[model samples]
Target: MKQLTIVGAGWAGLAAAVAATQAGWHVQLFEASNIAGGRARSLQQSFAGKPLDNGQHVLIGAYSNTLALMRTVGLKPDELLKRIPLDLRFADGQGLSLPNWPLPLNMLAGLSRAQGWNLKDKASLMQAAWGWHRARFECDLTWTVEQLCNASRLSPRVMTQLIEPLCLSALNTPLNHASAKVFLRVLHDALLGGLGSSDLLVPRVDLGELLPNVCVEWLRTRGADIHLGTRVSATQVSALQHAASADSAVLLACPPWEAARLAADIAPKWALSCAELTHKAIATVYLHCKDVGFNGLARPMMALHSHAQAPAQFVFDKGALSEQHGLLAAVVSACTTERDDVTELVHEQACKQLGLVNVEVVQTVVEKRATLACIPMLDRPEPFVAQGLWACGDFICGPYPSTLEGAVRSGQQVVTQISQVTHR
Candidate 1:
């Protein structure tokens, strides 16, 4: 068996390590950060003597590949995550909530019972949905989500109350610039993919506990070398020579910017393309409010009515989701506001929307380049950059958005291609 070198211990790198080790290869995993999970890791805070995630992340059943990878590593999804039927409640149960039923029907049932929507509004929603399904979610590469909605004649009520929020949450880009084709793909997979595709899987544990931390234990058991806080310099191709070998392969699973830096000397064109990718930021604001009543909006998560003063489009009740109490994670997706400004804005947003009077400022996290600005006709570099030197990350060329599933799927893909080549 040959050695497999994996750079970065993110979800993608972890999955690749697991797959390579299972295929009878010795694995060496390196991470620049001392902590395991990259962006999705938990911030170490002993609130109630337990863990808290940096931000709230939601997974759907459509993430089948990610779920399968978790199970392969002896992790139980049922125990780690809380599965809930598709629901989007806000301001006292005034939003979409799907009952337990098969898809399309579940979607219809939810539309039928959607609150704050008139009969005519519901009819227009149904008609637009049918049109999308009939067209198989296909659209021109240059079309924006806003344009698609307009062409379909989707009512403004539905756009404001549902589509717009969902779009921002998923694509992390503004509607006018977001890609319509990608939006339709997300809708198809989550809403019509399978029985539980639309179901939200909120992690009952911290993000690292759910995947990366557990992965570390599994990799150790399988005899893989783990290196943390070790930065692999990529100023020149010669810098990567220590890890590269005739019998060994190197996998660059780092983010776009870092990967581009490393690949600059190895694969210049690919690196330049990755370096040019436009990115957007995501900020998660934590507000600690004790004794604040749910006021009929008791759902674990809910959508919010956003504005200039209140930029957060969604709020996660960490107390209800996990053991954390009085913790609210308000997410401002695709945010460009300064950190201080966003936090202050979120405080006002919570009070304005949730009616929470008194809340302590816990902490604020802003990932400046949370994801690529998934705009229309975005270009991504190829994953197979060079022989024995391949790339894998959520930022790679893919049909899906930047997500855990995308990361894991990219890892799995690299492993498969490597296996075929080595075996041949």
Candidate 2:
């Protein structure tokens, strides 16, 4: 079996390790943090009184690669994730729900049911969908999301209820700055892929318990070496004349910045590509409340009012854990300014927006640089870096936005490349 070293313990690295091991390769996985899940890890705090995730993460039924990886680790989808139809609730007490419907039509119905959308807004949305379909068929990459949203004349209701949240969640960039091509790809897969495919799957447990920890156990059972808290500083490749060996095959599945630094000497081209990849930061603030006025809210997850005083982007109620402790969490995405005052502002917002009066603020966990900002139209690194070194991450693949699905899909692509090269 070929000896392969996989760097980083994020979703991409873990998925690559699993695939390579299953394909009869000797895999050694390394992680910089003591934990394995990277941004998706969970922790136990005094205030929450239970384990809490750095932020809330969700998956769609259409995410086949992520679902497949879960199966590989002996995890049942129904048990690990709470799967339900697409339900979105706005801050203005308006909501929209999409039942399990067939492709294209499913998205159409969902948009039509959206409250507060005027006739002109509906027409603009239809025009945007038509344009997206046309662009996908023609493979046109020239237009950006800013241009499309403008040309379509989308209403504020459609923009906030549909576009803004989706863009920030997927791309980690605002709509005006995100890539239109990649956004279209996401729509094509989930919205146009047919019924139940667009179902939203939220983790009922902490992120670490949900996937990464399970993955670590599964890999150990397969006899793969899993090394936590091991960081790879650099990678050196043997001269071409020396010929690649079993140990030559190394998979560098890290963030774009780290990957670029590691591959600079070994693969200059890949290093250059990595340097071209841009990133943005996401901030998530977790709050513990003693009492919540609303019950369950509309859905497990709800987008916050961006124009509010505190201006939280999303909020999740952990009241389900009242059987043990009283806790609630909220998230703020694309936080460009006011890093110092974000926690205080979010705390105030939770009280005013959620109507949680007399709630004491116990714990606040802030992930300043939660995820790399995936902008539209920015060039990303390719899968194959060198004869043995490969790159895999959400930022390396096609324009599907930076998401858990994209990360897993990128890992599978690297595995395929490694398999073909080794077999040849």
Per-residue lDDT tens digits for candidate 1, residues 1-424, read: 6888888898889989999888888998999998887778888874666676767788888899899989998999989888988777786667788876895688788988898889877888788888999999898889999999999998888888788888887888888999999999999998787788878898888888899988998999989999989988774333454555556788889999998898887888988999999999999998888645643236778888876778998888877777678888899989989999999989988877887787777889888988889998999877787777888888999988788888899988888888787777
Give the per-residue lDDT digits (tens) of candidate 2, residues 1-424.
6777788889988888898888888888889888888767877553434576777677888898899999989888788787778766655666557778775676688777777777777777778778767766223366566666776677777787778777777667777777767767776787766667778887767788778999999989988899898776773333321345644477778888788888888778878887776566666666656554445554556767675356567776666522224456676677764655777788788777777666655555555555555554567778888766788887785656778888888887788887887776
Question: Which model scores highest in lDDT?
Answer: 1
TM-score of 1: 0.96
**What lDDT, from 0 to 1, does candidate 2 have?**
0.73
lDDT of each: 0.84, 0.73
The residue-level lDDT of candidate 1 at 12 comes to 89
Which 10 residues in a row give candidate 1 its minimum summed lDDT? 235-244
TM-score of 2: 0.90
How do the predictions measure up, each by TM-score?
0.96, 0.90
